[model samples]
Target: MKLLDPYSLVLMASMMCGVMSAVLFLVRRSFPADIQGLGHWCAALAVQVLATACYSFKGTLPDGFVLPVANLLFVLGNGLCAIGLQAFYGRAQGWRMLGGALGFALVGMVYWLFVVPSYTARVTWMALPLTVINGTQLWLVLRHGRRHFATYFLAMLVGVNALLVAVRGALALVMPAPTVDLTQPGALQGAYLVITAMVPILLSVGFIMVATKRLQFTLERRSASDPLTGALNRRGFDAAYTRELARLRRRPRTLALLAIDLDHFKAVNDAHGHGVGDKVLVRTASLVGAALRESDYLARFGGEEFIVLLPDTDIELAATVAQRIQAALRTACDSGIPVCTASIGIAAQTDPRQRLDDLLEEADQALYRAKANGRDRIELAEQEKRRASA
Candidate 1:
């Protein structure tokens, strides 16, 4: 096949990438939780767009413009990708920032040295850093390769990068003699356009799809989680509790529920306006969540009230858990709420005959007693039962 002829396969890839970029942009707007990550992805797509443009205008654009534009795009895109990867792994700050800055500086040096000289030197200088970034991205995916979509996307990226490198080599080998035209290449003008255009497009499509889905997932999570406290909202809490109850009935696990109401919570809300009250709620939720085991779940039941679900925890252990929670909340301090305390009503399932409603009823009764007993106390349903029996 003549290297000058356009490859249909490459053209298809370019179209796909453009469509995917649009789709990813729309999807990114939907995710507030993953906004930073989505921004990084958007940056990556911008690079892909630049790459596509470079491929299209290769011979037409001045050598000065072409090499600097193309190489710089790749560098920026790769840098954004690294940042996005770090964000995904929750390690984007500190040393990673230092590393990213160093990488960008090196990329700028390469652009000045190679792209300013000639296309051939530009391609040569571009190879190592491009490979390093692509390889590092692939390694990250491989390390977390169990995710089906991530693996697929990473594979696609690797394939596209390899194609780019191959095209660069072909471009170098097939160019006309120095006397004829330093600007225009003879052998693979058409082929170069096709490959360069198509590769970024195809890779962009895969990346956009991945980024879009991730954005959607992040949106769903944000919908379910309380923004201030990181606990499940009323709807989320109900859904979770219902699911746990249903699961427990099938498997018959020892389950407990603690209904925690902050004493004088309304006073806090009234005294400091809603903002300070929100902070207190957030702090209290954090304290309570920290007190829980990984297996346990804590959620905001409603304003000033929270619910905790403990699987495989008996009545005694549940009371102990409640006491620990009480202590933690009492000690919590941020922006000054004075001394805060929670009145927790704890109930556990001892009999397989009991239902979730029954458990809740028992716990509620215990809570009423705790409030009646003054405030700032943990009262166990089993303890109430003992007193009633006596």
Candidate 2:
């Protein structure tokens, strides 16, 4: 009994799971939403603990209650973890598949316990469904989880447990010498006890790692964005612009920048209140963002100003996009706002060696000219005036 202390390890693992669940709850609140799938992960932990508790009373409890019920809970826990993995990847999962698997597990358990009389048969029956669930989880990680270290670690952990389960089932079904009981304290039984007790907590840890990794990524992205309009802030935009310049040097493509300023934005704030002004800002960003190509990048450049980077774009397309933004804002302002419009300044990189700051300064000059030209228009930076064009 002391040597085969599955109960102690199972209980300790359950306690660890409880601690992690509480930790995840706190960690989850810090993220944007329930993107971590912490709820399902925590529920899986609790379900696994409950399943183990049910199994701990194997002989003390009735076979019908202990065998089918405990196994069903175990399957449910695994299903939830699988769903959690899908959720973490921002993928949609078919709950019907899990429901069918769960139903099969229950039906198999009923048939094995009531119609069959052999312990070996019961072992193989439970093994098949459990292996299927584990294999499904492994497939998910292999398919969609290449970007993160957590995926690899989790796949390895689950793979080992799954192999152990398959081997255990094979041994129970085909071993020539029959054991007196599953708890007979032989090598096979000892290995089985250790695996069954240890795997739940280990799998829980893997779930926590993946969820935490994803949350970290989301937090990093939000940190680089304007919280109000979900546009890249000045710091984030600068980083991206620098990277694009490096790429442009190697690839030698025409990169265009559009510096946009909202016309009479201060008056909109003064007359209509800052709240409406904020709404206009959000609406402007949204409308202009929609008018650009997927490859084009938009970023908030502080106070009713924005920068759009159009990689591989010439001045013609850049001016067209600026005009589209102007038209979009014209209609938006006419309908929702009394008097709101935009003035855009365009600059194209003629020389690949042009610095980002210089490019921006030329665009700023054009922007200033647009403002000086009675606003609500577009101005192009004079390329001939620059020390080097573009």
Candidate 3:
């Protein structure tokens, strides 16, 4: 446990950080949709680890071999952090902007390493660019991460690290010249070295938390939605239908259900194949969505059948929606692989005492009638019979 000195300590810490970042990178790849730009975050940490390793070689290696590469990767690593966080918030870092900054850092490193070869000059050059990258990250988190505490902590870490770099750069201008040798104790040198050695682990932890949360959210959403058309799946539909029924009980409002079936969908699959039929299902969902309003719900009830809930809608309005959806499907398939149409059966209930199963059964019966009357038509449930019974 002699891991106390600046050089040895940094070497160990950087190695561990590199491993953690690499592992997290692999995990993020498993859910690429949820954690966008995580690959960049992983790359940044890996580069930072290498840069720290180069610092360990300070006097042992030639400046030409170590200085420029280390500083270049250091700056690039910080830049990638900014880029990755920007992606998390749906903001993108333009390549032109990134390339320009990266190029400038490289040019500066070459000038200092070859021409001046001063440690102070290299520190000043590396510090300023790192500050800008960190500052940009601070702005992104503040602007978009207000709701997430993980993001707030991330911003704070970046902010402090940026300030430390700025302070080190300023001290280099005033303090006497210091060599890359770690044996001699200098205040600014020891402080910044310790920080660079340590911050990556904390930063990695914070970013991983952010990524984990995003992955969880995405998984939850996927569970609720159909993979093909993005409509609510049967399980999700049942939950929603239950909620709508509860609402009807709390208040005296009309609730309508539309039981919809795709006409000749089996034939579409048989003639055009399942691939084309899937496209038709997706298109059918889109068309149904277009016909519905904000207070409506659409679910893939089962194969080739869908259920729609129209809140505060009566039989007439529901019938109109059903007709519009049928027409929309007909038009949508006019030029596609095969002609497609829909049969919709609607049922409405204004009484708070009515049961959900009763409503669904009425709608299903009406759907049967529409099929009996020939496909691609709308049918309404027998409200009069229920009214007479009540």
Candidate 4:
């Protein structure tokens, strides 16, 4: 059987690469500026397109001009891929090492093209650097990326590409080809061209998927978080409450809630302005967060009010946490913020059937009493008569 035209495959690969590069460029324009790596990846694809385009003109153009430029761009494109992964994973891009590798590859390409004119030597020179770059990219994804499908998919694609490049380089040394021209047809050469053409398209798909997943995760986090103080918002608290209730059903345990209202918060706003009031809220949230255990959840219920959910804690322990928050805020006065204190109401539930509304209501009533009695104090909610009867 005859092989498909190698030059045609190279042309097809160049077109596919160009299309993918354009797609990534368009996608990147819509992405947040903080998300790094897409630009690098887009540039990498563009460079690869140019490399393959130059390579396709192997017979038509001067070998000295086309071969060196094509191979140089190929090496640069692979290096850019490694740099892109580094930026994606928030790691330092090793520019010096990449520069050294590019320089070495360029020197080898030049020597083989003009001085020696060996096909196998040129293939080895190009392939080795690409293998290193691809291997580095695979390692970065495995080490820094989240353990998920998108991470594994990208890793697998890069690992396969690296392996192929390495094996091709090894084969070039062991089994030298008859001709120096890339357009020469052979089964191995045809397979390599097809695989190379397909891999970039698949790789672009994988990149888009990974980036989309990150964007989705960021949106989810922002939805659940309070923009002002970075605490959980009411909706976020509700989700947390539901999860805790499910856990409580699995194993019976005490769950406690603390409703905290900032004392004289309005006075702070009136005297110092809303800017100071915002700072006080932020400081109060920080102090409360510092006081709580890892197992606890803190949320901004509304303006000047916060809620804390403590799992495996009784009313006494909840009261201790409330006092710790009060103490933390007491020290905040000296930290260049307006003096702030929180009136806290504590409620604990041993029954898994109790809804969050019931717990919140009891805590709110106790908070009302704490404010009525005197501000800046902790009050424990009286157990319901239904609980006493039970």
Among these predicted structures, which one has the highest lDDT? Answer: 4
lDDT of each: 0.68, 0.79, 0.79, 0.86
Candidate 3 lowest-lDDT run of ten? 179-188
Give the alpha carbon lDDT tens digit for every residue of 1-390 in model 2: 456554565677667766766766676676666575667777877787788789888889897899788888888887887787777776887478778878887887788778866677767777787788788778887887756788798898889878876776777788642552445656656666666666766777787777677767778778889988888898888888878888887887889999999999999999989888888888988999999998888999789999999998888888889999999988874355555798989998857678888998989999999999999989998882352354
Q: Model 2, residue 351: what's the lDDT?
A: 75
Please give the clash total of every predicted structure, in order. 0, 2, 0, 0
What is the per-residue lDDT of model 4 for residues 1-390, given as tens digits with 9 covering 90 to 100? 877797778888889889999999999999887678999889999999989888778779988888888888988888888898888778999787689878988899888878888889888888877888888988898898887898899888999899888988888888857432346677777887789888888887887888888888778778998999989998889999888989999998999999999998899999989988999988888889999888799999779999999999977788889999988887776455778888989888878888789999999988988899888999888783244356
Select the stronger candidate by lDDT from 3 and 4. Answer: 4
RMSD (CA, angstroms), candidate 1: 5.9
List candidate 1 segments past 4 Å from native: 1-34, 39-43, 46-69, 84-125, 139-199, 226-228, 246-250, 270-274, 350-353, 382-390
TM-scores for every predicted model: 0.72, 0.79, 0.75, 0.85
lDDT of 3 by residue, 112-153 (tens): 767767767766777777788888888887887746778777
Tell me the deviation in Å of residue 108 in model 1.
12
Q: By TM-score, who's the top model here?
A: 4
TM-score of 2: 0.79
User: Residue 279 of model 3: what lDDT?
Assistant: 86
User: Which consecutive 10 residues in model 4 have the weakest lDDT in total?
Assistant: 176-185
